[model samples]
Target: MWTYLIHGEPTPGVARLLEGVGRALEARGFRYSPEAEAPNLVLNAITEENPKPYRRRAQATFVASVLELPRFPEEPIKELYPYLVRALSNVLLAYVPGEGAAFLTLELGHYREKEGEGFYERVAERLMPIACSRLVIDNIFVPDLEPELWEGDELTESMYRAGRKLKEWDLLPAPFPIEEILPPEDLRHVKRLYGIGGLSYGNLSVRKDERRFWMSASGVDKANLKVIGRDILMVKDYDPEKNAILLSVPPHVEPRRVSVDAIEHWMIYREHPGVGAILHVHAWMEGVPATPFNYPCGTYELAQAVAEKVREAPDPTRAVVGLKNHGLTITGRSLDEILERIEGKLVRTVPMS
Candidate 1:
């Protein structure tokens, strides 16, 4: 799962040293085992820990540790730990030189899942700005403070309890999805959706899935939202004949024009498959291109520029600051992921003078 380099005083009994390393690792959510028993001369002995564990043993070396992640070797422990220890050994090392054993612990923060879709890379690319943002809420505001048990894809009350306990440990929620409390009229016909946003800053509307790409009725603000039948706005339903072609226009509305942003929303869905939802905002310094367009202004150049920007992006799913002068487009299987990106991007930006 992760790796850590522990530095300490060498024990007269090598076996004791091994045991101490194992216990230290276990305390910090890692496992360790000695690799060479007394026989191999090259190494003293070996052992393994839960999840993933590794050990290194060589004669005349007090340097030993537990490793689980594959990418760790590129940045081995012996070299990294000493520097960390030189600075923190006084407070962190567990043993005294003549008294027995002590190790300077070097833990891998936040294990990144490496097997699928460059998840860690994506997180690194996307969250860097948020990780260093100024708009971050105080650690006290973090919700669900404990480690959530995966309850078949849904979090439960017990999980909530665990989170509360974790709060006692000071580990706050690192990221959460964005939420907009919409009104009843817009949500009446909706079955399922990912992202939710305020209509008039309070009334919320959600995009529908599986049937049509219907959104919420216009003029439904969240503050005074009422769950009435007219709030739902069913824009398009599944044709089952034309390969999922999306259609707009309700045919009966007065001004006849639905949200002008709908076409831009559709363009994103067409370009990126598996995009569950889209959030288009007309924020300042965003949503306006720097150069002039030759045609009706909705040119292929914008889409190409966006694709290129994301392709070159450090994180594919992250929201770019000033994408082609357009606001921002984020995608995710869940709404929180998208929201986290939004908040993170906002935090990363420094106000321009």
Candidate 2:
């Protein structure tokens, strides 16, 4: 997970793309400024045309900016926040542990043309739902020196209560069946699941049977030397209707309502089209620098940033980095492939200060 800013010259194609964009700008009775800050408008113009090459160039330019630019000034973390925020969402999705599933959904309207709507309101509308959905109960008042009730055991219970209430209201996402399957006795695959230590629990995804996929059950730690079938949990006939609703599981024990983040995962499948499996794990140490700053991970901006990255990446398989404090999401054509990416990222990632 490298982070920085990009600047200087961009791909020659980008310059050509910008030239075309500049023409479109003139057509719209707008003009580019001679100032250096004009690149932002030029880039926006390129997006308007929506050409493949131009978009590719834009992505390359963005990556280059990220790879090359200096650190963001402290005052503007809110303004110049990088796609890193969404990357954190991706990470947290991966490591969201438990028996249920988690996902993410982008507010398609976020990218829609809003004419003359206020930017702040548009941003709020697009991002706030994704953020607030996780809050469970709302509108409660809090006293100074006292935290909101959403803390610890009380908070956990409240979350469950909220989940139960959401389920009653039919507000939760449509669930995909989470079935527990006995994986074939392939020691290699077993080793892959338990590669980081603990037990040998493997994942296998089935797309031909879109209604169902297999997962190792809760309580069956992948590090255990032997994992039995009884330990596996099955979520059957999930998303049978293929609706937009997403499902999630809490991080605690037993069967609970699926996670609100499940919509994000559902969106991944929708956006990527062929993505079949995902592996998530909460990896520590990725947030060494922010630890001192007390900067939290997994916020709305992070989710949006990562969702855009996932949508833009040539292959979701390559989008491994998530929020620093959260975890990882690895998607691929099969469970084995997804798991490999998850393990590889964890094994190779060296923390930054």
Candidate 3:
């Protein structure tokens, strides 16, 4: 059974709602636990007046904060999204009695309601993917020979230039406002845990060799990637034994984790040798095939689903696939080729399901 934790204070309405949600989850095989033991998910209920965060834990722990908004705003994104992040939880659930509820993750923003009944069951259904998926984020760094690999290689230069192009197109969304949103103590915890100052959207990578590629570092500015180990690192391979992405970084510099989506990229690269490069952006394209479910990033399930979509494409090397409630993952001969093809055809606002 999957273990979970529900924390924070809630109002009468939220408590009753949580009771139903908890029961539904248990019926579907979820066991509640305390903070001391590692749990698969944590549902944090917070009040607007005291929007406190749960203690930091491994990235694998999915922390979703729930809040009750009286007569929830018609446009919650503009009116009340900041407070959700203020809770420092990855997913936010905003609920109202007569009006229904809305859901927001670090990725897409989705609003849902039930005119008839079973709203609680629907909410629990939407959370199933996140509650079940495993995050393959463990990383191993080796001080392997090759300053030339990460320093000034031609492919590496293309990575830098591609980052600039993405910035120019405004494809890279702003990194999360961790410092502005979290308290001083909680802020330190995040940095220490993730080795990242903030979380950002989109990651691009170009093939370095037959088995490896260079990827952007986790939680760094995609627009301005300058450092070797800090901003960009070479993904050597995915280690099944460790269930981690292995990287070859400069021996002198401290290495951070590669993009959380590195496993997804690794799977595609391994499956399609002709596919030379991959570009993932938080933007959409019309008429593109998207995954059926919105699985959490970095999971083997998501990787397998996206890879299957690419495999089904007429040309896996040059295909554009949409990630439902997420964005697009494009494959091309190089980053430049991917950039050229997607120049005029991109939807900035990704549609949520």
Query: Which candidate's lDDT is highest?
Result: 3
**Sequence-dependent TM-score of model 1:** 0.28
* TM-score, one value per model: 0.28, 0.31, 0.93
- State in Å the error of residue 313, model 2: 1.5
- lDDT per residue as tens, model 1, 1-353: 32323333323443444354445444544433333232111112211221111122211122223222223333333433433222211111222222322222222111222323433243222222211111100011111212221111121222223234323333332211112222343233121221112122101122345433333233332122222223323334322342122333323322111222333334444454555444433222333222221111122343344455444545444434233222343444334344445442332221121
Kindly state the number of residue pairs that clash in model 3: 0
Model 1 C-alpha RMSD to native: 24.1
> RMSD per prediction, one decimal?
24.1, 21.3, 2.0
Q: How many residue pairs clash in each candidate?
A: 30, 52, 0
Model 1 Cα shift for residue 155 (angstroms)? 18
Task: Flag regions of model 3 displaced more than 4 Å.
Answer: 33-36, 56-58, 78-81
- Full-model lDDT for every candidate: 0.29, 0.29, 0.82
TM-score computed on alpha carbons, candidate 2:
0.31
Candidate 1, residue 141: the lDDT equals 12
